[model samples]
Target: MPVVVVAWVLLILLGWSLVYWPHLPSGFVFGSGLDSSARASWTDAVYLSAVTLATLGFGDIVPADGWLRIAVPVEALLGFPLITAAVSWVLQVYPALTRRRALAVRLSLLRRVDTVGLVAGQRSVLAASVLENLAMSMAQLRGDLTQFSETYNVRDADQNLSLPAMLGVATELTEAARRSAVPDVRHAGELVEAAVGDYLDVVDKQFLRVGGSAQKIAAAYADDYGQRIAPAVSGG
Candidate 1:
């Protein structure tokens, strides 16, 4: 968990540095032309970076030079996606870490059991483990759903088809675990396996969505480049 936190912090800092480091001269206004007095020092550069990246545009300090002006807009563009990626990574990993800790607690309880003649206790342990697994799975699924919801709040059909699909898988697993006569430890494992299979089916569909999106992007780029190069190719 600490590692994930540190990694995200480093990534955010690196992203900020990428946008702000180039114009670090001492107080230079962006696009102030090549000879402008606005040489941005380190502190000034960082301040300007915050304003530009945030789109605050206080207007107290402006980009008077061409590259600085160009750099400002580029930074703004990068800021949105960088911040989005950082937030998304944090949202995904935090719940996963919480689930890991919960799972560890359940496993610790499981490890102390003696396995000899403890039929009733073994059933209890099986039941507890099943519940723990289901809970963890649901937490993760909820996190995914919340993220998808936030990403597209309008709830359109194609906006987020996977959210309900994941919820359905979780519900089914909960139902399987609720079965009273799930039998001994052997069948308990089988029940867990079945639940996992359903979840993985949803995961596979998510991967397919990614591939489909990539293909669309590739086709668009190919068509665009073909148009730009067609005249030159014909002349040649």
Candidate 2:
């Protein structure tokens, strides 16, 4: 997301510089102690673009009357929002990324124990509680991915905190919970299953934009992280 945003800014900078390049010196007013040549260098065009887009007029160069004069303020108007959006992208993305990793960590920890067996026993309520939490986390994680689609590109070094790596395990665990005979545990499992399925649907359609079953899409999503999660995403 950050890369895309910054690229947009630089592209605009270059584009505007090209536009202003042909009309420099003659089209613009030159301040004292400046070389006001008929043919200004590319650097002068770029300098004008940088200063104008940043809304920082150094007074060394000024646009004379005509379209060039009007273009200066227009570029300045566009500059503020672009700079603001660039900063906002970094700030907004990290929180969503943090939440995503938190969910992965939670699901990853569950894989360490036999949650299915524990939920099947008389103390099923305790496991059911955990199952409910997992279901909600899955739902929240899905929402996070949807709202902050950019975080999909933000990867974690540790597989334990990587969404694509551990998400399939969450699906498999939820599937086991769904088969339990206990009403509470089974209900919680169903919730988790539904949440996971919905998550698969979102990632498949919006981000991946591929034509396939949810299982195949989920597998592809995990493949980006260098993990084979297709086997675990079977209960789709």
Candidate 3:
């Protein structure tokens, strides 16, 4: 969001400089000496820049230069891309943050249930119930990621199906755990733990993949071909 704000500020200054600079009472020139008319116009330009950057466009200063005329449309062009990148970054990070919070909640709930089961020595029943809740939460996360993939088209290389496939495997494990009623509670508990571990691993990989995709899209949107995120080289 700050990046977007700064971009708009710079863009607005560019527009205002291009606009009244040509038609000022003193002259259309950079670094002109300040006089009564020049200072007032300069202040007006500053005001206009603030409004334009805020997208207020208060109708005070208008462009008059023919050759410098392209600034208005150019500012508009730059604004949209900056705004889009800001929005996309929010969209990518917000869901991942939400999922992390949800996962923490699920884990806490499972631990409470586990303690209760151990106290009652009805380990298998409690474990199964915990597994069911975890499964449901995982299913919800899968649905959220599916919508993300469809909206962003980030997984288009695999026909937008890789995440769905991974989620399906998680669902299958949960279903199997739900159906098993073995007498060995320890074995059932171990199976559920293994399944959860595997699901977590898959989810981690998917997150890495999606994060990479978002970084690429954002850099492209910024027109940063030189990889500004690259580590700086130091002299030996």
Best-matching candidate per lDDT: 2
The superposed Cα distance between candidate 2 and the true structure at residue 77, in angstroms, equals 1.3
Q: How many collisions per candidate? A: 22, 0, 0
Candidate 3: where is the Cα deviation over 4 Å? 1-47, 115-236
The residue-by-residue lDDT of candidate 2 on 1-236, one tens digit each, is 56676787798888899989988778888988877874488888988999988888787888886888888888888889888987887788788788888887776666666555576565677978987887888788788888788777777778778778877776676767766777888888788778888888888777777758756777788887776652232232
- lDDT per residue (tens digit) for residues 1-236 in model 1: 33454575455545665556565553245453444355545555566666666666676666556766776677677567656766777686556544534433333333234221232234657564655565556455435534442222222132012232123322333344445444543355344445444433433354323233422432332232231111101111
Q: What lDDT tens digits, residue by residue, belong to model 3 across residues 152-225?
A: 22321221122322232333333444445544444554454454444444444544332334224333322322
lDDT ranking, high to low? 2, 3, 1
Which candidate gets the maximum TM-score versus the true structure? 2
Q: What is the C-alpha lDDT of each candidate?
A: 0.44, 0.77, 0.45
TM-scores, one per candidate: 0.38, 0.77, 0.41
When 1 and 2 are scored with lDDT, the better candidate is 2
RMSD of 1: 17.9
| lDDT (Cα, 0-100) at 44 in candidate 2 | 83
The residue-level lDDT of candidate 1 at 180 comes to 40
- For model 2, state the Cα shift of residue 52 in Å: 1.2
